[model samples]
Target: MAMLTIKDLNVYYGVIQAIKGISFEVNEGEVIALIGANGAGKTTILHTITGLITPKAGSIDFEGNDLVKIPAHKIVSLGMAHVPEGRRIFAELTVLENLKMGAYTRSDKKEMENTLEMIYKRFPRLKERKNQIAGTLSGGEQQMLAMGRALMSHPRIILMDEPSMGLSPLFVSEIFDIIREISESGTTVLLVEQNAKKALSIADRAYVLETGNIVLSGDAKELMNDDSVKKAYLGE
Candidate 1:
């Protein structure tokens, strides 16, 4: 079933329209990608879904609740986690502290510790540097920390924005592998990525956006082989 559904989303910034009546749904245990260029309003869509940016018009339903009506913090407790662009970890905090912040909505300390241990297992580097200051980590390490932190929330669905941005080729490959692992571990994913090739490679379904509109959408492999996608996004 649909874990998250966005219908007729319209978002505006001042007098400029950012997202224009776009809609998409992410079902349980599926990886859905929103691939587009920088100005295609991809990030805006993720922000809107997570309740960070309110749409001028639309309905965002996560499970059964209208996300548009829910407060951002409350939304997190509703089983949605967002790993925003730029690896926005608290610069001064330790890796453990940053991860702890992600579980702020939860009250079960023992459960939180169990989740933290699970995260440490997935990101061994994080476990090794659990006490290291977050700001001191390398770019790739910071990205890992961000993902680990988001997982700490025990989300039913995770929204990842540009998880591979600015990484070295090896790190990029590693990050994409981890994304697939996350999906396989049974967490639904809505990924906003400019790395169309990598995004489509792992997505079960994908939507192509341009200037705030969804221009094409279908099975990920089919879109990967589409001529237009090759020329415009795959750099074929």
Candidate 2:
């Protein structure tokens, strides 16, 4: 069974439609990339799935439960974590404090501690700066903290929005490597990215969105080699 399924999904902000009736599915343990240009509604699709924006029509099923009716907080408790765009870390909080906040919905102290240890293992920089304030961290470190914070939730699936944005080439590669490591460790990933080639290269499957609609979708390898994708997104 799919870990997440969206059918006939639509979203709007007041009178303007942000997402058309789009559908997709994320299977357990797969890295699925949603690739698109700016304002293509990729982020909007993520927001709707996570309940950050209510859908005007359609259904979102996560592990067989209806997500449209659930509140955002409740959705998080259901094992869906979203690392939004712009790395929305709490600027004034310490790295450790920020990680703790990710587990606010959980009460199992032992498990939380284990997860924290795991995050530290995955991001040694975060461990080194656990006591440092978040706002002072460099861009690369801030991205790591944001990702680490999401992992603290022990989510079954993570929704990441433009995680490689605004990073140096070295940092972009590092972030994608981390994403691969996370997927190998058994978490499903739904990634939205503007860097289409990089994202498709690492994904198991990919969807192409344009102007608020999905234009194409298939195995990532195939999409990466397609002429149109190469010309339009890969700068080939």
Candidate 3:
């Protein structure tokens, strides 16, 4: 079964429409990338799915539940975790504290500790900086922390937006590698990214969005090879 599905979703911002009837699905254990240029409404789609923004019309179904009617905080408990666009970690909190916050919805203390250990094993840097203030970390480290924090929720599906937005090439590569590892480990991922080549490289499937609509979608390798996609997105 598809892990998450968005159907005929339309969203508006004030008088302007940001997303127009775009629909897609992320299947279990698949890495799905939504690639688009700035203002193409990729983040808008994610915000709607996470309940940060409500759609004017459509349905967001995840694991047989309608996300549109659920509260944002409740969405987390339903096993949909969102790693927002900006690496929005709690700036004042220590890395450990920030990670703990991610588990606020859970009452399973023992399981949360195990997840924390798993995260630390995945990114030892986070373990090294566990006591450091989140704001003091470098951009790359902050991004790592954000992903680590999201994983603390032990989510069934992870939604990431622009994870490589501001970082050195090395960090960007590292982040994508981690994403691949995360997917391989069986956590379904829905990625929104402007770094088309990198996103397409790791994606199982991809959808190209243009001006609030999906213009192309298929296997990642196929989209990577398309002439139009190459010129417009892959910088080929």
> Which 10 consecutive positions of candidate 2 have the poorest summed lDDT?
71-80
lDDT of residue 67 for candidate 1: 94
**lDDT value, residue 65 of candidate 1:** 98
TM-score of 2: 0.98
lDDT of 1 by residue, 1-236 (tens): 58888999999999999999998898899999999999999999999888899999999988899999987878888999999999999989999999999998889999999999899888999999999999999999999999998999999899999999999999999999999999999999999999999999999999999999999999999999999999999999
Q: How accurate is candidate 1 locally (lDDT)?
A: 0.94
Q: State the lDDT of candidate 2 residue by residue for 67-91, as single tens digits.
A: 9999888988999899999999999
Per-candidate TM vs. native?
0.99, 0.98, 0.99
lDDT of each: 0.94, 0.94, 0.94
**Steric collisions counted per model:** 0, 0, 0
